[model samples]
Target: MATFLFDKIIFGPVKSRRLGVSLGINLLPNDCKLCSFNCIYCECGWNPDQYDQKINFHPKAQVKESLFEKLSQMKANNEDLDVITFAGNGEPTLHPEFSEIIDYTIQVRNKVFPQARIAVLSNSSMIHKKSIFKALNKIDDNILKLDGGTEETIINLNQPVGKFNLDNMVKLLSKFDSNLIIQTLFIRGEYEGKIIDNTTNAELEAWISHLQKIKPKEVMIYTISRDTPSDNLEKISMNELEQIAKRVDAAGFKTQISS
Candidate 1:
């Protein structure tokens, strides 16, 4: 498997294809991947073997302290920043003190890079919680994933390990009322013995219908860009991505294709 875990509380002011010059903040454990969904195309590999022992997550004060130091140092060095993104080993919203961390991050970010946007890349599994929903609503870019419109496709692609279902996710996403950004990943290949493709006509029509229902502020369409846990999956070409974007745009939703 092609594993790419970020073993740190704070990492990278790396170039993001969509977010641009982003600084990452990971709220999960630094030593392993902890997520609600085991996405087939995740660059972070499968969840760690020591999942039950993952109780040593960083404390909120420590996260705040580290973020403050890093942001202050970056500001001192005059490094340009476009966004402070919450993305790392796994789902950031899973943190017990996630709301507190976000509040602290916004304070520190405002002190250092007042113009920088606070963005979170989430799987949209926890939005059902009122607290998670409120915290996400405070950010500048609330980017949530909607990989598949149907339950079977979601299970095959995202592989939610809990009671999460596509029907509830769609309903939760629609609650944003066009205030959020809808991110969709298109892929086709095989994982295990089954054929995996969310780009089929049936899938696309269903996905587009959900997009219409959600009525997001923007629709981000893209495909695989890195080595995935499932090696057989292939990246959809830029041309194909553009074709999908065109269709989304025609539906009266603003679209962006990150190739």
Candidate 2:
């Protein structure tokens, strides 16, 4: 399977399944992926060996300049932008000046496209950081990932690189107090000889329990819709996704399915 990366600081106002016409901001390196989690289903492919590669994150000044230029041009052309998303080759919050960047993005959005919402599509790894947590709270759409329920499922599926604690992450998510949106990618396949499936009845039970605790405003349920680094993964169908969404809805939370 062939995967791709966004090779620019400001990439697209691409038609997203979840987000409408979204203008993306890539604060990570334009060349390689730099993320806390190395999920097998990542469209940017697996995390590369960074032992020798120099990771150059885009500076806050550069991001501000590029975003202002792009947003100004789009406004001038009368473009339609529903949201300004912080999503790129990797985790957008990993940037050194993530909090400052979010502040700047909000300022820019207010100046150019006040109607457009600001979103950060994070994996929820950096939520423990006070600055990152504060920044995420400030965004219009604080969409974070919770791909699985149990620690084993998360470790097998998301493959967090360094220190990771699923319980702690869930606790941090609960801190949002319904201000955030939980995005779960339901996947079932064999990865590295382990049968990976998060859509099972038991899995759903546990996941819903976590959602109950987290109490996000909405739960965005979907599956793999792009070329993944691993070839053994399977995309959950719309029917299956609907079934999952129903469970989430039954648990007393709003659900959005993007099959």
Candidate 3:
């Protein structure tokens, strides 16, 4: 297992492999792993217990005010901000006032750094919630994640509990008419005697078929660029990712090879 990469409520105006110089908005608590899916490949490490609770839910007004203050300081210093991203240690959509927070982030962003894009990196677990979908639509980049096409692999890797079946999740996600940048992390490993390989041709075919059905505007094909939770996990090679990108481009979908 890997050590948690971030520990603050608000972190990194740092370089991101996907988002670039992103100002992160941590919707989760400053500490703890709060999420619906405890992924094996999660850089935050695995929360096998699946105990996702809000330790400290900040008041929306306070969060907004603090953000405004930070933005003001950055503007005063003549610093550039590329993107304001919502990606904490846990699920960003789990915040009770996520929509309002997004509204507030946008307001502050426009007032201070109008050129910077507002992005939300989410796990796509709560897209079924109408409010969550509505909030995501407001962002410049709605980076949604759907790693596996099959229910078995989804359960094994993502480790989402309850009625989080792949079929239902896909059906729910289809309601989002907005162009979504779907992200899939392709990897291979063996967990508890079960072989896990999302890069397999069968999985790729299934993902492609689902992509045709969902019709996302773009797809991000990525591999493990950082250390993960499970020891059995293996990163996909660059050559393999490029091959996948070619197929995705051939299908008329915008694709980016990132790791």
Best by TM-score: 2
Clash counts for all predictions = 0, 0, 0
Specify the poorest-scoring 10-residue window by lDDT in model 2: 46-55
Task: Please give the lDDT score at residue 102 for candidate 1.
Answer: 86
Each candidate's lDDT (Cα)? 0.88, 0.92, 0.81
- The candidate 3 region of ten consecutive residues with least summed lDDT is 46-55
Question: What lDDT score is found at residue 119 in candidate 2?
Answer: 93
lDDT of 3 at 177: 63
Task: Tell me the lDDT of candidate 2.
Answer: 0.92
Clashing pairs in 3: none
Estimate, for each residue in 1-259, the C-alpha lDDT of model 3 and write its tens digit: 6657456556768898877788887777665667878888888876536345435765677778768877888899998789998887878888899999998888888889999999888888888888888889888898888898788887887888456777777776677663688889999998878899888888888888778777788898888877787898888899999999888888789998887
| Superposed Cα deviation of residue 182, candidate 1 (Å) | 0.9
Leading candidate by lDDT? 2
Q: Report the C-alpha lDDT of model 2 over 144-250, residue by residue, as the tens digit.
A: 99998788999999999997888898999999988999999999898989999998888889899999899999999998988999999998999988888888888
